[model samples]
Target chain A: MIGVELRKLFRRPRTWATIAVLNALPVLVAVLLQLTDLAPRPGEGPPFLSAVLTNGALFPLAALAIVLPLFLPIAVAVVAGDAVAGEAQAGTLRYLLVRPAGRTRLLVAKLLAVVAFVLVTVLVVAAVGYVVGATLFEAQPTGGTSVSGTSLSQEELAGRSLLAIGYVTVSMLGVAAFGLFFSTLTDSPLAAALGALAVLVTSSLLFTLDAASPIAPYLPTRYWLAFVDLFRDPVLWRDVVRGLALQGVYVGVLLAAAWANFTTKDVTS
Target chain B: MSAVIRTTGLVKRYGRLRAVDGIDLDVRAGDVYGFLGANGSGKTTTVRMLLGLVLPTAGEVELLGERMPRAGRRVLPRVGALVEGPAHHGHLSGRANLSLIDAAGPGGSGRTRRARIEEVLDQVGLGGIDRRPVRAYSLGMRQRLGLAAALLRRPELLVLDEPTNGLDPQGITEIRELLLELNRRGTTVFLSSHLLAEVEQLCTRVGVLDRGRLVLQDELVRLTAPTGATVVSTPEAGRVRAVLDGRVLGVDGDRVVVRGADPAEVNARLVAAGVPVSALALQRPTLEEVVLAAAGTSADRVEAPR
Candidate 1:
């Protein structure tokens, strides 16, 4: 079932289009940064955007930081939202259920497929950012030093980049699970996608307000940028752990609710 | 013969509306059982329950001697079905859709899967167009593809709901012949339809449903057997109508339909009166009339068969 689901996910042209569009953003940013020849001062944008101006290796981290808050999550939302509702809207749910795919198994397959989509999307963006950044920027300055003024080995840079990608993947799981829950509740893929986006937007809105301080830490979007802490000299673990724990709660609760509601659904479509 | 499908006092309710009232069915192996009903008469609902797609509010369903839902996983592989209509991804080719469904089932090697997919496509007359996107196919072609998917596993029992709903006359004939051929190969077929003529011609046995209840069920031969009225056709119909007196049920052009009269006696009476009957025949009610009478919507005022 997982094999079949993955095959379906990859076969659609829309899937590739979404990936291409996402990767294009980082390429555009690299070009603009090269043409301007003006590096952002500290704290102007995401944690690594300023650093990428001198050292091209850091651009993958910068691209992830720029997209993680909105673009990546939205891309994950679209795929996850369509996971179940798309089948229902196409009137194929009845045929699938009649095959006795077993509601639980089908739901699990869809969730895994969404997770796979998230991983692929994030990696493609990072890879594109790396190539564009390398082409446009210098690997080492004339003084033979990076912005941090410390020479890092190739192995360490590779390891940290992978960790950054892993963290981003985990953070997006909450949105994926939320999208899937909405997918089970409705037959329209567009409605499901919008519904999941509404929840994320509301969470982000609350996170920005001082009045929402009491509930801010629990919001799904609160610690999304914690991946930045990975590139810090000592690697801060405080908010990173919190982010993982909070995402765990979201994934657990939302997936449980999705399964409970979907198992007993009438499947009239 | 062993029963292929048996339902005991099955019921399903959506809030206060009882979609399927308590109904018992016995579909024996090797018989083509036509489940007949009007548009909203609960035929689709019952088919859903039997396939474990919808849980019944009350009662039990047994398929191939095993309880449903609990045994759905164990039993579904042996059963192939096309519920409501052909539901598939519009963007996928006909071959791709079948391959996906076949892969979702329990066990099949890649070689076997490919061979079976090709074989069923050929059987359904979709040989060369297997690679075409399903969205480009016509409604009749989709119906054929649906049938092809159902046959991919060479299932022991085949269930189809209104398989010929939107088909033209030629397409309908093609489906009827395919179903008959499959049945001849020892597949037990259970189908639902509102078309009385289709069922009368294709099914050996039938169960008629009306407004969430089973009104009548019997062998097709017994149900359509001559049981009421004798029709007498003659050029002198105006004269024959007078002799038959109150026995005449109604006058239909040149034919005088009479009730409770033997064909020989009616012939003698008409000839003796110099009516010169050209044709004297017993009137066997058609399946359509039987269904309408059972549904209590008959306009011709035919007597209900006991």
Candidate 2:
């Protein structure tokens, strides 16, 4: 069932369009960095934007940072939002339910499909960023010097990149789950995607307010940037662990609600 | 024979409106049960309940000898259905849609899935167009594809709601013949329709519903058999009316409808009275009449024949 869902996902022109648009962001950033020949000052822009100007190998991390705030989540939202509601709108949900896939199993497959979409989009951005970074940015003068002045091996770089990509994937799960839950509530895919995005916007808004300090620890978007911690020299696990835990809670609660609602739905469509 | 589908006091209420009121239905194995009702008469709602698509507010549904919404996983594998209309991904080809649905079913190895899809597509007269996207299909072609999907699993019982809807006359006839052939091969069919003529021609047994209530349920032959009156048309209408006396149900133009009298007896009396009958025939109430009667409407409610 998941394989079928994946096939359906990849066959759509919208899926490829979304990936292309997402990859374009990193490409644009790389080209601009090369043309300007001026690195961003410290504490400006995304975390690694300035750092990548000196070491091309860190460009994947910078690309992830640039897109994570909006581009990546929006793409995730579109795919996840369309997961069930799109099928319902097309009048296919009734046939799918009647096949005895059982609502729970079908919902799980949809969630998995969204996760697969997130992985593919993230990897595409990272890959495109890597190639652009290598060609446009100057290689390290000392061959492979870390920001902290320690020499790094190829294995270490690959390991950190994998960990960083994995963290970003987990961060997007909350949005995927939110999109799926909204998908179950309505038949309009656009509404579902917007609803999920609305939640993210609200969470981000709350995170910036001093008055929302007490509730900040539980917000869905709070730990989204924690993937940057994986790139720290000492590899800080504090915010990363907290982010993972928060995402797990969001995924669990939202998916449980989705299952509860979907299994009892009348399926009038 | 054991019933393939049985429901007891099934009800589905949406807030203040009861879409499907308390009703009991029995569809025996090997019986072609025609579910009859007008639009919004709960025909679709009842079918949804039986298939576990809508949870009943108050009732029990036993499908294929297992309790529904509980054994739905096990029971649905043996039943095939097309509700309202065909619902498939318009972006996908007919073959892709069928393969996906087939993979979701309980049976069929990967090797046999292709063969089964081919057989059903051929059976439904869509053998050549399987590669076309559903978006390009006409209404009739989509309906045929819906039937092909239902037949993919070689189900023991088939439930189709308005299967011939949106079809041309030739298409309707082809579907009718196809359903009859499937029944001959031992697949019990349960279908719902508003067309009295279609049901009358296809079903062995039937249940009629009106405004969320079951009005009548019986064998098709028994329900439609002549039971009301004998119609006699004669040029000597005055003489015929005078001879018929109390047996006359009604008089319309030059014909007199007489009840509780045999055609031969009425003819003999009319001849004795010197009323030469141009036409003497028994009026077998059509299924439409029975439906109207069961619906509690007066016989004259329908438009009179010119």
Candidate 3:
């Protein structure tokens, strides 16, 4: 079941199209930085944008920051939101259920496919960022400076980049869970996708409010960008670890809810 | 023969509405059971519940002698179905769609998956079909593809709803033949359709559903059995009416319906009376008349409340 679902997801033209579209913004940023050499002042724009002008290796991390706020989450929401609702809308859900494809197994397969999409999408962003950043900017292949102004070796830089990618993937899993949960509640893929986005929008909104400070730590999107802490000289694990734990809770709870609702749903479609 | 699909007091309620109210369906092995009903008589709901797609609000569903929605994991793999109509992923070719659906469940061995897809496609009359995406298929083609998917596993029991819905007359004939052939090969068939003509031609046993209730269930032969009346066709209808006298129940055009169970006996009496009989046979009601007399008004019709 999982293999079949993965084929369906990857064979779709929309999946590749989404990935290509995701790389567009980061590539555009790299080109602009190369032509004009006007990088954002330190800590002003994206996290590593200023540093990417001197060391291309850091540009991948900069690229991750560029689309992290809104673009990547929206992409994840659309795909995950379509997971089950899309099948229902297309009238195939009934057939699958009758295939004796146990409802629980189908849901699990869909979740795995969504996770695969998140991983592939994040890795592409980082990889494309590395290529564009190297070709467009100056490169110090030996090592690069960390966010804390401490020099890090090439191996250390590579390790942190991978860690950052993994962190982004985990954050996106929370978004995917929201989309998947909503997907089970409706037959309209668009509505499910929008519903997930609504939660993210609300969470981000509350994260910025002083009155919501007490609830900030509990908000799903509050620690989404904590990957920036991975670039600290000693690797500030506080916010990064908190973000992972927070996303873990959200993914676990939302998936459990999704499984419960879907397994018992009347597949009239 | 053992029962293939059985239900006891199967009911599905949508809040205040009883979509399927207490229907006890008994479909036996090797029988082409026709489930007859109007548009809103809950036939589709019934099949959905049996296949575990919709849970029954009350009562039990047993497929192949196993309880449903619970034993579905073990029972459903042996049953194939086409509910309401056929549906498939439009972007992929028909073959691709079949392969994916077959792989989604257990018992579909990967080594034989390709051969299985080809065999079912041919059975549904798509043997010469190319790799064009199903989005480009006509309604008839799509319907055929749906049947192909249902037959991919060679299930022991086939549950089909309006199987010939989108087909042309010839296409309909082809599917009926295919279904009958499958039935002949030891596979039980539970056919749910509103088209009386289609069911009359294909089913051995019939059940009529009226407003979520099974109004009639019996052998088609018995329900449409000889009405104990002999129909006589002759040019001199008046002479036959006068000759039969009290036995002549009614006369229409050149035909007369007289009270007699045996056509041979009626013919001898007509011959002795010097009446020329063109055609004489024992009368039997059409399936349509039997159903209309047994079932209530069409569920789709709504009359103003007093």
iRMS of every model, one decimal? Answer: 1.1, 1.2, 0.8
Error of 3 at A98 (Å): 1.4
Model 1 lDDT tens row, B176-214: 999999999899999999888889989999999876888
Each model's TM-score?
0.94, 0.94, 0.98
Q: What DockQ does every candidate get? A: 0.73, 0.72, 0.83
**Which lDDT tens digits does candidate 3 get at residues B221-286?**
999999999999999899987777799999999999999898999999899999999999899999
lDDT of candidate 3 over A1-269, digit per residue (tens): 99999999999999999999999999998988888989999979989998888999898889989999998999999999999999999999999888978999999999999999999999999999988878888889788998899999999999988999999999999999999999999999999999999999999999999999999999999887789888888999999999999999999999999999998888888
Question: What global local distance difference test value does model 2 have?
Answer: 0.88
Clashes counted in candidate 1 amount to 0
Q: Which TM-score value belongs to model 2?
A: 0.94
Off by over 4 Å in 2: A141-151, B269-274, B296-306
**Residue-wise C-alpha lDDT for candidate 2, range A47-162, written one tens digit per residue:** 77888888888888889999999999999998999999999998888888888778888999999999999999999988988888889887664544444556667677778888
lDDT of 1: 0.87
Residue-wise C-alpha lDDT for candidate 1, range A45-104, written one tens digit per residue? 766778777888788888888788888888899999999999999988877777868899
lDDT of 2 by residue, B112-159 (tens): 998999999999898988466899999999999999999988889999
**Which is better, 1 or 3, measured by DockQ?**
3
Worst 10 residues of 1 chain A by lDDT: A140-149
